[model samples]
Target: MKKYCAYVLLGLAVISNAALAKEAPLVSIPTHDAFFNAIKAHCGKAFQGKVSKDNVGNTFGNAKLVMHVRKCTDSEIQIPFHVGDDASRTWILAKTGAGLMLKHDHRNEDGSFHSSTMYGGHTVDEGFPQVQSFPADVYSKALFIESGIAASTDNVWQMMIYPSRFSYRLIRPAREVQVDFDLENPIATPSAPWGYE
Candidate 1:
């Protein structure tokens, strides 16, 4: 009877070990998001510009945004300088049945709040501008305020493109802000011209 009990316990332990070995690693995805794989899929370069607004209830500025995509892994991108101050890493976590997204932990310098309507769209097909409308993967209202630099997202992230690069501007919604940069030939080393972070 003692020998039989020992065999049963051994079998149970082996089964438990096997189960644990077969588990997959955890993938992080925030509950709410703002942008998706919009710029990456459409624009083949990093966005290095700014979006600002001005008088008469109108606002606009030079918008510089840089996003890169890494295959089979999370993105390591630099928004550079979106708001007023150094750049902050906004984690756009990986998701299933969807693409890249922006993590919503809104905090900036001076303890102020900034909320914007975020949308993500990409050019799935390449032929002409009148080919087909891009599918907006995700959208959200995001607020980025003041927080310590070390308090950013603590997870692996990915950009929207492989070797990502492009720049654009909102220039106050309902208008197209100009983007000026070398889409074909980007600098050998990525740079933060606006000096965000």
Candidate 2:
């Protein structure tokens, strides 16, 4: 029965292929959860930072810089970035359902919101656990355009955290600003940010 043998061989091949598919290991991409947890690991700590690279100009020349990982929640982390005595900026990192968001919260000395505040970006992909990059979002681009800094529309901000150091960086067409903080040495926590206080 040649016809019967052919049917049996076809069935066997199909079953074999199904078995192989079931035995194959699944490959998964690195998730935002890993990246979020990496920064959460350093809550309630403060570190001093210095401008490591500034190709644009000396915007923060010789000013004492500090970042305090002050407030943390299950879905958010707030870091106050202080430069000298000017404690008007805070970095808010939040876990969105799709990915992550980084927002800059700027305030005046009297705890009033600045006109050009709450501008940042969202992650477009599942970034690495040690580092993440956020391209300027629509809101940020609109704010930049409205504020006459349209060149910042192409901005991409990046943050890196490791066992020994942490870094915050900004990149655009002709501008690159980077600040590195020593994680191994914890510094005294600074005062609350302008709006937070």
Candidate 3:
């Protein structure tokens, strides 16, 4: 088992709040398909409310999760290569009969890649960590408290993914706050980031 290191975020604040409360393109209703990178372009200005925390304090603050879609001979996936000051993590995406899912190729602080699938499933609980399946591994209950989004009662599922490694705890689908971050890069990614041969 290869141990992949983890990633962390940098800072927060600054930049007008204009794009703060924006919302990413809603996950289109899908059931099964190849990977797509154009969705990565969706990284621009979007997200509703502010990000608060994720995976303890591993991935928070202002960071962008820039990603692009690519296809392989046997599979299609999304490669989200996040650049942060402390840590960075990547994600691989695929579509199944259930919906869009990440492969769970994350690394541990001790530098060990995931032994099993951290992502990929329909109802989330199907996977090991569970608590996900909606927006991939971006917002898992384990990830939320792990990163630093433990401030409010908002769950990690309502977090945003770009312009800043931030997550939001939705109070009423209208009220939220930017999340936190860890201190490691390449922390985890079900799939893989770009340029990882």
Candidate 4:
């Protein structure tokens, strides 16, 4: 009888474990969150990047580019984009009920917002896990026009993640810019970006 009781207790323990496992979620988020998860995977790392394509010469082609996947939360991520010694740009990604929203935060060295700051777009379609694109939003278009950069009204930004590289790209009728970074080799984090501690 004692041996029979031991067997029943062992079975009960196994059943309990199974029940506990079922109560816990198998994944933190749904499967459709692939693109967002891909970007979130490198939360605390910083990577050096180079200009892969620049149809128009600007500060980007001449400066050293580094992208830091800095502050992150469940619904928001802030990545600082450094060009040489300038820390004036940050890319903000936020999850919304419909899709993702991308915003740019441009600040002066003294932590003041620039005249043409906080312009960006939102994801319009269901992009793949490896890539996502944001088209200029209504506010962004208006801001561009008001800021006297009317040509930027038609801007679109895209981000892609691969096994060994991450890319940031800008597409417009007259301009195309892309920067590629090595994901497999991350360098030391640079100094805190300007306007940030």
Q: Return whichever of 1 and 3 wins on lDDT.
A: 3
lDDT of 2 by residue, 33-115 (tens): 77677778889999999898999678797799999999999789999999999999999998766678999999988999999
Off by over 4 Å in 4: 1-32
Instruction: Measure candidate 2: CA RMSD.
Output: 10.9
- TM-score-superior candidate, 1 or 3: 3
Would you estimate the TM-scores of all the predictions? 0.34, 0.83, 0.34, 0.82
Runs of candidate 3 exceeding 4 Å displacement: 1-59, 62-65, 68-75, 85-88, 108-111, 114-195
Candidate 1 C-alpha lDDT tens digits along 1-197:
99999999999999999999884643333321223333324322343433322233323332344432222233323233233233332323343233333332333443333343223333233312212223333332111122332222121222222223333322222333332333445433343322222
Clashing pairs in 2: none
RMSD of each: 10.6, 10.9, 20.2, 11.0
Full-model lDDT for every candidate: 0.34, 0.89, 0.36, 0.85
TM-score leader? 2
lDDT of 4 at 178: 93
Between prediction 2 and prediction 4, which has the larger TM-score? 2
Separately for all candidates shown, the number of backbone clashes (residues 3 or more apart, or on different chains) is 38, 0, 67, 0
How far residue 164's Cα lies from its native spot in candidate 2, in Å, is 0.7
What is the Cα-based lDDT of residue 83 in candidate 1?
A: 31
| Rank ordering of all candidates by lDDT, starting from the highest | 2, 4, 3, 1
Predicted model with the maximum lDDT: 2
Question: What C-alpha lDDT, on a 0 to 100 scale, does residue 59 get in candidate 1?
Answer: 37
lDDT tens per residue, model 3, 6-120 = 2211122323454686654434332222113333433222222223433344344555433323333223343443444222344555545344455435554444654432532
